[model samples]
Target: MADFIPVNEPLLDGNEKKYLNECIDTGWISSEGPFVKKFEAEFAQTVGRKHAITVCNGSVALDAAVVALNIQAGDEVILPTFTIISCGAAIVRAGGIPIVVDCDPVTWNMDVNQIEAKITPKTKAIMVVHIYGLPVDMKPVLEIAKKHGLKIIEDAAEMHGQTYRGQPCGGFGDISTFSFYPNKHVTTGEGGMIVTDDDSLAEKCRSLRNLCFQPQRRFIHEELGWNFRFTNLQAAVGLAQLERLPEFVQRKRKMGAIYTELLSDIPQLELPLVKTDYADNIYWVYGMVLKDEVPFDAAEAMERLRKKSIGTRPFFWGMHEQPVFHKMGLLKDVSCPVSERLSRRGFYIPSGLALTEEQMQQVAMAVKELFN
Candidate 1:
């Protein structure tokens, strides 16, 4: 038996140790440290945004974005049912209703065409979450937002170093967010950032992440906010990772290409769409959907792969199908067939930055043998 290949392993062989050592030597390990500011600034510049605010994690970044946009109760925020719970949770936590639409079957991203139909007078924002390896068609979403006067909250958490129509992924919306989870191209262990061109919105996010602290007075708060602060130690890791993003992206793309070549002959699988009119795939993860004729779902396939020491991860379950959403009396009676099918059928292979050619070949062989 081969070594158990985990679903994701981060590549951290850059300046991470050097920067972390500097932090320890200087005693600047908290959120007030200098590395946090440096990471925020560099990340904002890279994404072509005017302001970037660091938060403890990606979920709170969405939370801050929702509050910063002032999405109040009874206000509806349009989003895809195919995304992670964070997108809808942010709105629900802000007392706003989440109005979800289905994703495009091919792109596996929020269907831009369906977004307009879902819009209503109560709609306040459109949360566009770029799916596993591709972007939601932003041009149509942008037009829809402009037509309806709705805010656009771009979630580029899975799309670090990726672009849409030549523009950076995180630069497309009124406010954008990114995660620095270990699985991402840029890993900070655990961190997230919000970027925006609007100074007021930027300021709101900064205040929101730090318990809405007043500049003039300590321990004083004008509005209630969470302690979602990213520490300097995390920022040190993030800054180092950010510097190597271009290299990481290149490696990911190469890995994806190799996997596509290796698995393209398998008729029972639907491989990821490699390109679109707007942009080429950065291949954050090499995902596949089991065709209807496979006679088995992703769960079964993943189990079989696990027995062979090959790890896998299921695709995100749709928000409409979430039991918690039903418990909260949200998204009740909502049906998105595409998202439902994807949730059951899709799974991603190991395409992490640290994945090597030999491991990739082993994974491909295991998958092929299982199908045979």
Candidate 2:
């Protein structure tokens, strides 16, 4: 079998093992310890957030964000239809209705134009996902949210170190969430964090992250919360990864540019479109849309890539069509045309940190030949 290139891979050459050793030697291997604090501080600084609250995973970070924002039952939180389900799920978990809509065809993110139409009286927040490391067009989203009394929760899970209009991806929303999953730009084995500028929200987030401990006394509980804490071991690894985040982002951007250059003339595939102003895409997943007139289906193309040992996969089907959402009776007359079309036809291929120049070239060549 040929060597299989992956979509994403953790680069562990830096201080991962060294920090792991330090964590092990210190015996603060559980959720508590200094490493977590250090990681949170560094991460907040990276994103220009006033505070950072570490958590177990990206999902938990979102959940915490909603709760900190005081989202109540029946309240609506707007989201994109084409994205990882976790973005919407966090709202439901926090007792809010997830009002999802279509994203832009160009950016494959929230359609800022469509947002105003969906705003109802009950709308409380908006969860804008920075899909595939491309920040959502936030200038209008923020303006609309401000006109109404809606808060923005940025899902920056796939976009570490990505910038938009000179601001970091996570810095746009009132509160943003990040993932340190192994395959992310930065890895922590498994971890997440919430970034925010609101001191009250941050304080609420800090308390909520650790099971609502009373400041007056450690044992005394105030309100119910989760033990969604990031372990010292994980934080140690994250710190190491953070130190090299800039390099990772640069390499990803370079790889994306190379892919575009090589595949520019390929009529079978449609490359991603990043609007000039917010196009500082970190290229987390390297998504590619299939040409409307492609002879073969995107799924078939994915199979071809896999057969060549160059792994690829199709994009998310719109959430309303998902089995889970269907079960919730969300398969009604809602039409998010862009998301609906892209979901079935768009796909991404391997673009991990470990991909060498030769590997990237080979994959691009294979794609061209497969289509020809």
Candidate 3:
């Protein structure tokens, strides 16, 4: 058997080490260090936002955004059922109801057509999560938000460097959040950011992440907040990673192209949609859905691939199907058929920045062999 191929391995050969050494030499390793501010500034400019706030991780970033937006008890936020639980959890934590919409089968993103129907008088915001590599159709979403007078919270965590009709993904909403998990395009090991053009919202987020410390009295706090600060070490690494984002995006595209070329002939697989009208696929992960005729679900397929020394990861389970949500009496009777099907059949293969051409070929061969 060949060497095991993990689902994701980050490429950190650039200035990561140099930046870490600088942090150690300067003895500025906390969130107050200069690098944290630098990372936030550069990231805001890169994403076309006026301000960016760093948090401990992407999940908390969503939490902070929800609170900063003033999502009160009984307020409702509409989001896709086919996304990480963090999306819905944020709203629920704020005592707001999470309204779920179905995803488009092709793009694997929230179906824009179904959004308006879910809106109610209680609806305060629409949370748009960009899935895998393709962005949600934002034009309709924007128009809908405008007509309804609702805020937009864009989850561009998987869409670093991606655009929608030439506009940057993070620039579209009232507030946007991103994750720097190792699998992301620009990673800081385990960090997240929230960017916005609103000055008041930016300050609220900064305060939220730091226990709401008053500037006049360091020990004084006007309200409750979390200690969700990003360390200087992580920011140093993120700054270096951001510098190489273009290169990483290019490499991911190339990897997607290769996989599509190799796997297009498979009759049992449903490959990711290559391009939508607004943007091309960035292949955050080379995901495939088994056709209805296939004998096994993703779990069996992943186990088989593991035996062949190839790594695989299952897709996000729909929020409606989650047991925790059911226990909480949320989304109990709601049904999203497309999200359910995708969750059972979809899984991503190794397609990370660290993947080499040889590994790509080997993965293709292994996948083909399994189907044969």
Candidate 4:
């Protein structure tokens, strides 16, 4: 490889520094400011949500959504095992049991087909994570939730601008969360947002993000809340990002095409799957499966790719099998064989914004060479 290609890099242009400097000059760099509200509005418009309330990070976005739903302790919130630990963390913080399930090997998203079987009297909600920019099939999940009156919390931490049934990913759920971390589809340095169609829920989110204050009076601490606020400086960066949303989505899809065209015939790899109607799969991080024919385990594969200057990441460690939850006796009868199996066998090389078609070709060729 001529140069090391990173998985993802934020495309910062068009007055990013100017906007941040403006925030500093105004001396309103703290959480509450015009830029914060402006970014929230633009984000809401871009994602097709009625409201968007900015917060600290993606985990906090989910945390505020779950807290607003008022899930009682011991209530269960179903999620996928093939995700970052933040989803489980939010559920635990909200006093709910994190009911994790395996993902479909093809989509690598929550096994929506298995969800109904897991619903019970204690089930309160379902958090759908659109992993790798492939939006989860939401129609069936929504139907299941409606029949049982369960809230749907969308973790669009990875899937921004992705659509399902002509609707944006986040808008499908009762409450949706977005992560604007540096590496996400968009960025605000480090920030998160919760969006919702319900005005009451939106109000609740605003209150929750601002330490549960009454808002009418600055010092009237209405309820116990945390400091989950986004600074104006971060918001300034996000505003610039939001303006390029269309171009960003377009570029992502184009890069995805490069990966698909090159890897289509590689039996050792399985590309990301999609539903027929979505018409969108913004490549937040393009993922692929290394079939059993490959000699090395996922860790070894990552090590090999690293030596070649091709960065790769292993699949998420299955949450049910993690020591953190095992200590709580959460996995006594959990037998998600697929999740556990894939966690060890699968590794993925991301197709990020910085990679050119030529770089992707080199990546694919390197992997093929390794398998031989």
**Full candidate order by lDDT, most accurate first:** 3, 1, 2, 4
lDDT values for all models: 0.93, 0.85, 0.95, 0.83
Q: What is the total number of backbone clashes in candidate 4?
A: 0
Off by over 4 Å in 4: 216-222
Candidate 2, residue 150: how far the Cα is off, in Å = 1.0
Cα RMSD of all models vs. native, in order, equals: 0.7, 1.6, 0.7, 1.8
Model 3 misplaced stretches (Cα beyond 4 Å)? none
Best by lDDT: 3
Q: Write the per-residue lDDT of candidate 3 for residues 9-38, one digit (tens) a residue.
A: 999999999999999999999998999999
lDDT of 1 by residue, 1-372 (tens): 889999999999999999999999999999999999999999999999999999988988999999999999999999999989999899999999999999999999999989989988899999999998899889989998998899999999999999999899999879999998999999899899999999999999989888888989958778999899999999999999999989988898899899999999999999999999998888998999999989899999999999999989999999999898899999999999999999999999887888999999999999998688
lDDT of 2 by residue, 88-147 (tens): 778777778878879888888878788898899999988889887678888999899989
Cα-based lDDT at residue 348, candidate 4: 70
TM-score of each: 0.99, 0.96, 0.99, 0.95
Model 4 RMSD, rounded to 1 decimal: 1.8
lDDT of 4 by residue, 267-355 (tens): 87767763446656676777776777777778887787788888787778777877888787775578787777678887678566556
Candidate 1 runs further than 4 Å off: none
Question: Native-vs-model 2 lDDT?
Answer: 0.85
Q: After best superposition, candidate 4 residue 74: deviation in angstroms?
A: 1.2
Candidate 1, poorest ten consecutive residues by summed lDDT:
213-222
